[model samples]
Structures are given as C-alpha cells and as structure tokens.
Target: MTRRICISGASSGIGARIAVDLAREGHHLTLLARRQNLLDEVAEQARAAGATSVTPLAVDLTVPEQVRPVLEQAGRFDVVVAAAGANAALAADAQTHLKGMAWAAWHWEANFRANVLSAVTLLEGLRELDALAEGASIVLLSSIAAYRGSGSGSYGGSKAALHPYAYDLAAALGPQGIRVNVVAPGYIAETNFFQGQMSEQRHETLVGQTLIGRAGMPDDVSETVRWLTSAGARHVTGQIIQVNGGASLGH
Candidate 1:
C-alpha cells in the first residue's frame, strides 16, 4: 500500500536517492531541505520515479521556529528519514588560532547542531504537532565514525549521541507502535559530505579498509533505509544497522 513519508536532506545525496526509491513504490512524499532549488529538482525526479505525490518544503533544520510552521501544515507522516547532517571539522583548520581549546569546542558544537539537534528539532516538532501516524518508522542517518572515530572528533561524537537517543525513543514510542532506528555508514563516495576535499590516497585507504573492497554508493545506504522502513523490518527497532562493509570491524 502507499504510505505518507517525510524525508529531510532530500535535496541531494542519500536523502534524494531514498526519496526517489520510495517514490518508485508510489508513496506520497514530503521532501525537506535548505536548498529550494535542489529540493524542487528532487521533487521532479521523485515524480518521474513514480511517487504518487510530492511536496517540497525548504527550511533550515537548525531553526526550530522555521520547522514548526512546516510541520503544522504538512499533515501526518507514516515514516520519517532524518538524513540531514554535516562534518563541521572540515572548516576547523582555517581557524586554528582561535585561542585555547576554542577551536576544538567549536567543532563539537557545530557538529552537534548539524547532526544531532537537526534531527531532534524535526522529530520534536512532529511529536508536538501530532504528525506521526501509528506504526510510523523513523530512521536517523549516522556514520560508522560514531564507533571508529573520524578525522573530526566532533563528527563521531555527535553521531554517537544518536544511539542512546534512538534506544530511548524506541522505548518511549513502542507503546504507540512507532519505531526508531539508526543507519551508520562509512566512506560513502559521491556524497557532498566530503565537499570535494577527499584525496586519492584517503579514498584508497577507506576502500581498502572495507572487506568488500569497494567504496559505498548512495544506493548502499538508501536501499538499507528502504528496507528498514518497510514491513519486512517490522520487528527491527532500536538497533544500529551498519552499512560500512566491514570497515568498522576493528571497532
């Protein structure tokens, strides 16, 4: 049957791919992101991919007030994919002389806001607006860095915070037949995450770490998410599903 789904970060990368994948199943979708132009492009792709309906909403997840009005008008959702996140440490090297320890602290704060709080604010608004349907599925995008650490300490630290939060939310929402889970990915290539900063050596190193001997594509994560939100994964909740291809084995 067709379901009503909401996906944040739907402008590009895994989020856009997920929206299109689900759209092929003819589901109704609400796509959210900060880029209006990109969101519109994704919406067209979703429609072409076979989505029964599509609504694109441009809003910054960092601001709670902006999200409230959107949630208030978007109606209820049966599935929510919190795919918005960033690695703020990429910009840290430019400000290395910002006093004692401030640089490190800034990295932590920026990542927390981008990764953790962005999802929190959206989910919180959904709860307050009573916009989640019964038996809804919620998936938060995380990284294997949460376990093995990333170039930026704050990136991994921020993602790690989601594990316990998912567990707690699973318990709290179980009574209402709502499920919450996480997907931790590693070294997914072609994503905007690296921001064109990935080098050949680093790319080779990450692929080598994977037993599968290949870099992950957007489909690697999106397909996993598709299953998690489907009826096949009805019994799965509060678990961290890793899509790292054995890269986190050392963890």
Candidate 2:
C-alpha cells in the first residue's frame, strides 16, 4: 500500500536514496532539504521513479521557524525520516583533533544543532501541526560513531543523544500506534560526510574493521529504513538498528 512520507535531508546520500526507493513503491513524498536546486533534482528523480506525488520543501531543518510552518501545511504523513545531520568539526575543518575545551564546546554546539536539534525541530513541527498519521513510523538516521568513538569530536555525542530521545518518544506515542526508531550506519561510501577528505588509508582502515570486509553504501542503510517503515516492522520501535557490516558491532 502507498503511504505519505516526509523525509529530511532528502536531497542527497542515504536520504535521497530512501526517497527514491519509497517513491518506486508509489508512495507520496514530501522532501525537506536546505537546497532548493538539489531538492528539485531529487524530486524529479522521485517522480521518474514512480512516486504518486512528490513535494520538495527547501528549508533548513535547524531552523524551527522555517520547518514548522512548512510542515504544518504539507498534510499528514504516515512516515517521517529524520536524516539531516552533519559533523560540525569536519565541516569546520580540522577542529576534531584540536585540544581545547572552548573549541570542543563550539563544535559540540554546532553538531548538536545540526544533528540533534534538527530532528527535534522536525518532530516538534509535526506534532504541533498534527501532521503525523496514526500508526506512523518515524526513523532517525544515526551513525555507528554514536556507539564507537569516531574521534571526530561531538558527532558521536550528538547522535548518542538521539537514542534516549527515541526511547521516550516511542513510549509516549505507542498508545497512538506511532513508532520511533533509529538506524545507525557505519562507513557509508558515496556520501558527502567526508567532505572529500577521505584518504586511501582511512578507507582501508574502516573496511578492515568490518567483518563483511566492505564499506556500506547508501542503499545498505536506506533498505533498512524502508523495512522499518513498513508494516512488517510494526512490532519494532524505540530500537537502534545498526547497519555497519559488523563494524564495532554496536560496541
């Protein structure tokens, strides 16, 4: 059956792939992203992939003012995917290795705004808008870095914060037939996460840690999200499903 889905970070990487995959299943999609051009591109791809309808909303998830009003009018959603996130330390360049409390504090705040509060704002908007359908599933995209130290500053810390939040959200929404869960992926390739700074040695080191002897791809994570959002996973909620090819094995 087709469902109405809302996805953040739907312009690229795993989020984009999930949108297309779900679109192919003939679902209606409302994509949220910061870049209108990119979001439009993904929307076209989703349309070509057989979506019943696709709406692209360009707004930064970190800005509640922008997110709330837009979501309030997009109609109710049967599924919500909170996939917008970034490593502030990496984005700021070389800040991850710096050794200063002040630097760490700034990095933590930036990462929190991007990773933690972005999702928070999205969910808050949905709640206030009454945009979540009964029996809806909410999936938050996370990283194995939350479980195993990435040494990339507070990226891991921010993602770790989502776990407890999902647990509480699940309990609160369970009676309403809504489910909340997180999908934590590891070493995914073809993503903008590395900011084009990944070295060959770093690639090998990451793959070596995985028992599967291969790094993950966007679909690896996206497919897990697809399943979790389906009726087949109705019994699952408030859990962090790791798609890391055994890397860190949830530590």
| Tens digit of per-residue lDDT, candidate 2, span 2-111 | 89999999999889999999999999999998989999999999999999999999998898888877887789999999999988777845456657887878788889
lDDT per model, in order? Answer: 0.91, 0.90
Model 2: which residue pairs collide?
none
Task: In angstroms, give how far residue 2 of model 2 lies from its true place.
Answer: 1.5
lDDT of 2: 0.90
Expressed as tens digits, the lDDT of each residue in 153-186 for candidate 1 is 8899999999998999899899999999999999
Q: How high a TM-score does candidate 2 get?
A: 0.96
Per lDDT, the best of the predicted structures is 1
